[model samples]
Target chain A: MTAYTATVTVRLKRGVLDPEAETTQQALERLGFELSDLRSADRFEVDLDAADADEAADRADEMAERLLANPTIHDYEVAVAER
Target chain B: MTAYTATVTVRLKRGVLDPEAETTQQALERLGFELSDLRSADRFEVDLDAADADEAADRADEMAERLLANPTIHDYEVAVAER
Candidate 1:
């Protein structure tokens, strides 16, 4: 089995009222940051002991779908770190 | 100014009771994931109009310190995407 690290990001849908995100955006703008697009997401770093990269990804995806995110209001993506 | 993309990740310090992070970790373990360290953080994707990489990074760090994170409870790191 190979050890892999997965970084998962979960974000609310565009229309969702993410107060935290909104506040951050406003704060950034106030700090003289000129941004074209600003999006906020939640990140998770999971160290996985899996059979391989594929298995790690599969398990991470499953975890995101089942528990890490609220499917109706949030979306998620997983990035596996290269060894 | 150059256009740059920055990804900032903010997380609560260790031992902070992150309900979301805890739940995610538990779910992963249940799904047969063996992990050494699992941390939860918040991610932001910002498209910045800056003079260059250094400027963008400087602005990003300022944003993170002043607004994107609560210094007492949360810490943040910024990653600049290469164009």
Candidate 2:
């Protein structure tokens, strides 16, 4: 088995209300930083033993689908790299 | 000015207690997914008009330093892409 790190990024779907991002944008503006828009996401990195990159990605994808992301409101992407 | 998106990823510093990640790992184990370890992070995507990629990255880095991440406990990275 090879060690692989699966990176899963979960973000709210488009048109969803992102109060956190809004608050962040306001905070940046308050600090005199100019920005038109902002969005926020959660990223999870899982280190595990797998046969190959594809196997690692598959397991990570399942984890995202089952726990990391809310299917109705979140869109997630999974990437794997050898460790 | 050109449209750009700045992606800032914030993660806890090593040795910091990451309860969320620990809980997530436990949950995945309960779901029958095998993983040795897991780490969680926050990512922010800021869309704005900037003079260049470097300028966008600079602003995003400042945002991360001032608001998005806690310098005492978190580490962050900033990436910029044309939008």
Candidate 3:
């Protein structure tokens, strides 16, 4: 088994109500940063022992879709760190 | 300024009290996964117009330290996407 670290980010698609993201964007603007089209995302990190990178990525993606995120309204991506 | 995307991950150092991580670890174990030393991490995605990649990374690291995380018990790293 190979030890791998996975970082998963879940975000509401555009036109979703992201109060937290909106609040942060407002705060950033108040802090004098002109940013537009701001969106909020949540991240999860997991360490797993899988047979290979492909296995780890597949399992992480499945976990994201099944438990980590609500795919009907949210989108997710997994970034696996090199071992 | 250069438009770039930044992904920041904030994680508690080992031995910190991470109740959420513990809970998730337990859940994963119960789901037939034997895992140990589980730590939790948070991810943030930011879009910034910086002068360069280094500037963007620096600003992101600063933001993660100053606002996004409590550095006393947490460590953060930033990954910038190639534009």
Candidate 4:
């Protein structure tokens, strides 16, 4: 088995209300930073033993689908790299 | 000005306690997934008009320093791309 680090990025689907991002944008503007838009995402990195990169990615994808992301509102992507 | 998207990824400093990541790892294990370690991060994507990629990255870096991350315990990276 090879050690791989899988990165799962979960993002809110378009058209969803992102209150946290909105609040962050306002805070940045208050600090004199100009930004037209902002979005926030959650990233999870899992280090595991797998036969190959594809196997690691598949595990991470399942993790995202089952727990990391809510299918109703979030979209996610998974990528894997050698440790 | 050109439109750019700045992606700021904030991660916990090494040795920092990450309860969320630990919990996530345990949850995955319970679901019959095997993982050695896990970590979590926050990614903020900021869209704005800027003179160039450098300017956009600078703004995003400031955002991460001031609000997106806690310098005392977090590390962050900013990447800018054309929209």
- Computed on alpha carbons, the lDDT of every model, listed in order, comes to 0.81, 0.94, 0.75, 0.93
Full ranking by DockQ: 2, 4, 1, 3
Model 1 pairs whose backbones collide:
none
TM-score for chain A, candidates 1 onward in order: 0.84, 0.98, 0.87, 0.98
User: What is the lDDT, from 0 to 100, of the residue A14 in candidate 4?
Assistant: 100
Ranking by TM-score: 2, 4, 1, 3
lDDT tens readout by residue for model 4, B3-77: 999999999999999999898889989999989999999999999999999988888888888899999999999
Per-structure clash totals for the candidates: 0, 0, 0, 0
Could you give the C-alpha RMSD of every candidate to the true structure, in order shown?
2.7, 0.7, 2.5, 0.8
Candidate 4 chain B weakest lDDT stretch, 10 residues: B57-66
Instruction: Give the range where candidate 3 chain B is weakest over 10 consecutive residues by summed lDDT.
Output: B31-40
Off by over 4 Å in 1: A14-17, B15-17, B28-37
**Candidate with the greatest TM-score versus the true structure:** 2
- Model 3 TM: 0.80
Better of 2 and 3 by DockQ: 2
lDDT of 3 by residue, B1-83 (tens): 77888887778877788898778667766766654435567767788888889988887777776676787898888998745
Residue runs of model 3 more than 4 Å from their true location after superposition: A81-83
Off by over 4 Å in 2: none
Candidate 1 Cα deviation (angstroms), residue B62: 0.7
Model 3, A1-83: lDDT tens per residue? 88888777888877779888778767767766655435557777778878888887887787777677898889889888755
Chain B only: TM-score of model 2: 0.98
